[model samples]
Target: MDYFATVLISSLSSASILLIATLGLAVVFGLMGVINLAHGEFIMMGAYSALTATQLGIPFILAIPVAVLVTMVFGALVEIIIIRRLYGRLFDTMLATWGLSLALYQGAVLIFGSVSPGIGMPQINFNVGDYTLAAYPIFMILVAAVMLAGIYALLTRTVYGMKARAAIQVPDMARAIGIDSARTNTLTFAIGCGLAGFAGAILLPIVPATPSMGFAFVIKAFLTVVIAGPVTLAGSALAAIGVGTGASVVASFMTSVAGDLFFFILTVVLLRLYPLGVSAKWRIKL
Candidate 1:
């Protein structure tokens, strides 16, 4: 029973990263209808940023916000330079963003080298007893909780969110009402990418700071993102956390790879049974 408890607790921490990481994708899909394959690149960039900050002698806590800021700036620049042009063409957007992802990855190789960087554990984990509880992972979960709550408040209480939702519901009407669709969408994408950056930074110690680390999580994220409905942030969050925890629990009893494969297969089967996603009926006002 203690073993089970340990796995469950650990799984919550793993799920926390996925929840925070994929929430950005959900926002972009919900607000702008843009399928950005480069979202994962934002995550990679952030991880690289954290690695850079640490190498420069910065503390992890301080380096985190810096990493997030750098990533957001990068994301905004990508929006202005590449993503903006492919506004209405999803296939173009996907292809272009993917191309950009490749470029960013190659650029990372040039700048940081292909070798992965290591992030240190927090000081508190030295006293975790036999529980295997990593302080950093617990800290990550707290940050994710704060972010999730903040997003809820924004979506429900802010004017910007309302306008974004309005644009999503009726773009033509939203434009007629003086909302700049282009500007709104750019911000939306940047926000999504920014969150990815934050997620990546939080994961600095949990995973390797390799250019490819983001790639692994991105595939896992996409599986849950689409399964959560290309829209619906909450759905994505729930699915991400759920899968994260589920995978961990399964892995405790089985091989890591097998656990992941089982979860992936389970997700596909769930999708087939409910093609519209977990909360599609509730979110889509038909």
Candidate 2:
């Protein structure tokens, strides 16, 4: 029973971390229909921003918003300059963003060097039936839950949410209704990048800030969003929980390689079963 409980809590913690990492991509690729290859770089940028702020004597907690703001502003500029022209051109957007990603990666390498220092993880731990567990991972579960709820509320209840949805779903109608679709789209994109920034900032203690760090996360993040299908947020949550928890559980009992194998195999089966995505047929707004 103790072993089982330990595995369960650890698995849930892994799932929560995955969920947090994937949320920004869900908003961007899922809602905006933009395949932002640079998404991972945005996350890297956030991590570096927070790290720099902390090094400059800013409290770690307060640095999170600073990272978000930096990324959001940069995202808006990218949308205005590059993404705006590439809308509806799938391959073009991918190529452009890919180039942007390379640029950002190289820039990071130049500025921060290949390897940079990592922030210390808060030393908080608890006993779980004789098995010690870090409190921060458990805290991630709550953070994931709150982030999910906050995003849902933001996109469903707010006027901005309604406008953003309208702009994405029916741009013609949205424009006809006197809504500035272009402006809404830019804001939506910025918000997505901001969310990515938030993820980097929050996960800094665990993941660290490195030039190549984005590569470690971007693929998995993209897969989670892709498997989420049409209902980006909810579907992503479900996918993260299913895949992340399953992998973590397997890793706890076996080798980490086995866990990765399970993750890939499960992803293949899911894609084969739901070609359009698990939430493709869901009759929901978000």
Q: Quick one: best TM-score, which candidate?
A: 2
lDDT score for residue 26 of model 1: 72
List ranges where model 2 is wrong by over 4 Å.
none
Candidate 1 C-alpha lDDT tens digits along 1-286 = 6666677777787788778777777776644677788777788888888888988999888888988788777778888898788778989998988898898888888887888758766667633346556687777778788988887777668898777677666778989999986677667677778788887887888776776676877787777777787447677777878777888778778889977987798798879876977767665421
Give per-model TM-scores: 0.92, 0.98
Q: Name the candidate that leads on lDDT.
A: 2
Per-model RMSD to reference = 2.3, 0.9
- Model 1 weakest 10-residue run by lDDT: 125-134
Candidate 2: count the clashes. 0
The global C-alpha lDDT for each of the candidates, from Candidate 1 onward, is 0.77, 0.92
lDDT of 1 at 3: 68
